[model samples]
Target: MKASAAMRTALQRQWQEGGWLSWLLFPFSLLAAAAVAAKRLAYRAGWRRAERVGVPVVVVGNLYVGGTGKTPFIVAAAHALRERGHRPGIVSRGYGAAIGPVPRVGCGTLDPAVFGDEPALIARQAGVPVAVHPRRAEAARTLLHQHPDVDVILSDDGLQHLALARDVEIVVQDERGIGNGLLLPAGPLREPASRLRGVDAVVTNRSGGRDGTLPTPPAGVRAVDMDLVIDSVWRLADGERRPLPALPAARRIAAVAGIGNPARFFATLRRAGIRLDATVGLPDHYDYAHSPFAAIEADLILVTDKDAVKCPAPDDPRVWAVSVSAHLSDPTFFDWLETRLHGRTPA
Candidate 1:
């Protein structure tokens, strides 16, 4: 069932409060959890073989079913890998896109609607080869075949897809850490919190917070803190770029975030010292074909880079996109990630 605005807000509250509604749905969570465990066990017991696509695969995913800065993290990680002498290509499920048998995504190829917003945005921002298919393994293979020099495969949100064997797994979490701690239809988690213990690394995207430290992870698991640096805002009309401070103080603003955690986006704007008259949290990967901006009272509209890609050039010049980049606190995570991707320990 599509979550209503009230339901989405209630779920967000439940993540923090663990209210009665979450308790009421707990029975179903158990059934969902058991099924999830059995599927993983099948892969572990060799009942299902994980397909390896010749190159090392690094998966960036989240245990919770929402945005956890995976898009920005992958863009940052991909460039960092490139700097360390590895070519990275991306593979995604291309949710909400109509990717046919030919699933390759690049310049002069599929439109955002046809290729999916995330895949299209990744290709545009990362400037690397990307492919989208419901079957990620097929996407990865097609991506590799097209970009043969690609040394590493970065799987976007493929932790549950055990069909694709991965050498390194990095699970990212945002401010809404394991809300309600229950399985889908009840709470936010796709896997149990204990799943953190098995992954190679856990990254906390504390971009919304002011403090230096990330929220603590489970016991025995080392956590890396990441910040999303809001670099600039670009005019959606003429592609005119301006520093964040360039936002006109005269106009009232509305921060519109269609991401998994819209509050985080609003917090980002607040941290940037831009006070919003209104904050709108649309569903994740919201199609902006019919924008809600018309009803918004604010004179200016600000959106995330992800939303910016899907939103067509607004007729109004007041609309702008805030572009952000991920900054990981621990340099060692990359070194560790590099070693795992190469399957070699540094001398």
Candidate 2:
């Protein structure tokens, strides 16, 4: 395994199943917790002002530091709003990009390498305006400047970014919930589990409920369930819609996922009855600058949509991107959100 991947595995083990390493790192987490608390306090006490971008901002964020179906959820929510006659724009912190203070803003097919994978995916899939920068508030302003009709903004995973003032906060949690429920460096939680109590809505991704029910959420918080179903597979070379069952039942099939939780992608394909000969799970937000596909030998290759954005082998006919969409248990979640959002004065 690569050194970084090995370290990530080790840390995941430590975070999920506490050990001596997690305990050894607990002190550092305490310091991080202190800093996070102080920073949030500064915002709350008016020491640091949060800038609102003259629109109703709904932050689809995370408490856990990994995948929770936030990207697909944001795309799905954007579609839902557009269907309801509300124009929505998106803003992100461009997690894996090398951008500066100035925000990169645009619509249509954007370069994931320049704008970040998730934002690019949102732009392409939602066909809505998207802007990305380290400062999400700045990105929001830029997006609004270009798309002045945007009535709402769906922020991609900025729960801790207090500077980007939001009207509604929605936390997306996967089956892992909060690993070990400790702060950064010691556990997977970016914020305390108590953070859920204050959010406007909680989205549980694939809660694994047999009867299509989710666990009880924190008191008074509206909750919904999200499951990403493999919608279809498209050719990276020609953007052909190759259905899963139709993809030649012959040949060695290998799936590659460069996502926060790759196992989920592999399992989704498996459940879709795709007989794969191999699965390559890369690190979250993995840059394809060094294409793994060059070395992966397979007659057919499948990749997650998030990874597809930054894939270097778009011309390789052997590779295809799996298109997945979020299936919400309660469709009314958007209606509930829209009502609240419309209650506020949108920019």
Candidate 3:
């Protein structure tokens, strides 16, 4: 991992538990919490009006700051909505990218660096048009203008972005389930645990382990589990689909992930019975401007679908990308979600 990634990983470790470092940072978290509360109050009091893009918006986001598998859930939701006869388009803030206010539409052929890693992954996997901008509401407007057939918009990571008015709000959580329950600089949350109470639904993701049970939801909060099952594996050098077991019985096999939760990818591979020689976790949205595993002696380097977009095609053939599909614990979850879109059903 790069130096910046290492430092971030270290901080995330501190966020999972209370320590002197977290306590020292607790005062700063209060300042952030106060700012968030104030902004929310402004919106709630009508001091600031949220803009709508003339389409029903469904925002899928997390309170854990990052991870929690929001991108996979977005892709899954888009596919499910299409099957239910609703045309869906996706909008994102294009975080970690230098894109300006102007919206950038995305496709599988788009450059991940120019757009965003998550957007690129959604475009490639979900087969939906994606519009990215700093302001998600603007992206939604641009997406609707470009794809007039779309009657519903999915906002990737827009729970905190109150500028975009959403008809349905869904918060995705992982096994950690609000560690230490503190706000930023102290814990992982962008919003407090109370935020989940207002969301249309809460989704607990089994991103790290397949058989692993989901984190228990807070009392009175209804939550559902989401399983991300590995659907297939694709070779990076060439877009060839191969089963996990088919990956050459090489002498040394390793995995490297730059997503929010690298351990999830590692476990998915292990569950598939792939023996890994080593595992490397980098910061989320790790740009593959240069291959970090270039010098590794492994015969194959396993990567996740999100990280694969950055390495759509790598010079080295050892790199491979694993694809996963989000499966809700209960099929009825889609029934509930579809009900939310009923009023905005496409004419």
Candidate 4:
């Protein structure tokens, strides 16, 4: 379910400052936590069988509901795995797609509306085979069957989806951490904070702020820091590239983001030294087929790469897409990931 602005604001407040709303919703959160715990227990107890794919699987996910930079990390990890001599494939839930059993995603393969924007973006950026289905395990199998050369599979945002067994589990966290460290309805987390204890690695994603702390992981779990790097901005109309800071400062820039966390997008622009005269925040995975740009008043428009996929080539030339890359502060995490995947240290 998409979050409304009121719901978003209330949840954000709960994350920053706990109030009566969280306490009022605390009972429902308990129900959510109980259900989540029960499902996990069923999988662990083998009450429900977790199927394993032919190839190793790595899951990059977050406990909270909003954007924790999973898509960028998946794209970066897929490329990194390829560089290490392993063919990688990605699978996603296709949150906004209207698909059947399984649809393979690639550049020009399927419309973003049919395969979801994030999946389309990953396929385009990573140049790897991607498959989307509500059942992510089935999607992984479809990707592997279609691209037999893929030695590893990366499941994007499937931490709570226990049906898909994983060899490596990476939990991503924003600077907000767990957001009151409570479950759904009361807070932002889908699962409990204890879930981090079992993840293979915990990545703290920082977009703007300096505070990089998160709940400590279990003894053996590795924690890493990541920053979203906006390398360049490209105009969607003609694919013209310009350095982010090099954009003409005279024009009024209006940033539009339909992502999980619109604030992060805005913060990225501000950090890049662009003053936003106006900002439009839409629900995560918002369909831009309606085109919000018609009403926005500004000299130029800036959008996230996620939003760029769904937007039609604008009749207006002022529209530009921000291209971001995931930069891990700790390069050792990649080495550790590679070693875990292959069961041997990289030479």
Q: Over the stretch 1-347, how does candidate 4's per-residue lDDT look in tens digits?
A: 23567777676888656789888999999999889989988988889987899889999999979788899889889888888888988888888878886555554345788788889889889988888887888888778777788899999898989899899999988888887887888888899888888888888778856564566678878887888989999888888899987775656779899998888889888887789999888889988767888787888999999999888755778889999999998877777898998877433
After TM-score superposition, the amount by which residue 76's alpha carbon in candidate 1 deviates from its true location, in angstroms, is 0.2
Model 2 is weakest, by summed lDDT over 10 consecutive residues, at 207-216
| Model 3: per-residue Cα lDDT over 251-318, one tens digit each | 89999988788887788788778889988888777787767776778998888888887764556888
lDDT of every model, 2 decimals: 0.84, 0.85, 0.83, 0.84
Query: Which one wins on lDDT?
Result: 2
Candidate 2: clashing pairs of residues: 54-347
Please say which candidate is ahead in lDDT: 2 or 3.
2
- Per-residue lDDT over 227-302 for candidate 2, one digit per residue giving the tens place of the 0 to 100 score: 8887788888888896666675557889898888777788778777788898887988889878888787789899
Estimate the TM-score of every prediction.
0.94, 0.94, 0.93, 0.94
TM-score of 2: 0.94
Per-residue lDDT for 1-347 in model 1, tens only? 23577778877788656888888888999999999999999998999999999999998999879898999999988888998998989999998887788766564334678788888888888878888998888888888888899999999999988899998888999867776677876788898888888887888888877443334676655578888988999988888998998876646888888888888899888887888888888999999877777787877899998888878656878789999998889877777788776678632
Ranking by lDDT: 2, 4, 1, 3
Runs off by more than 4 Å, candidate 1 = 1-3, 107-110, 210-220
Count of backbone clashes for each model? 0, 1, 0, 0
Better of 1 and 4 by lDDT: 4
Cα displacement (Å) at residue 194, model 1: 0.9
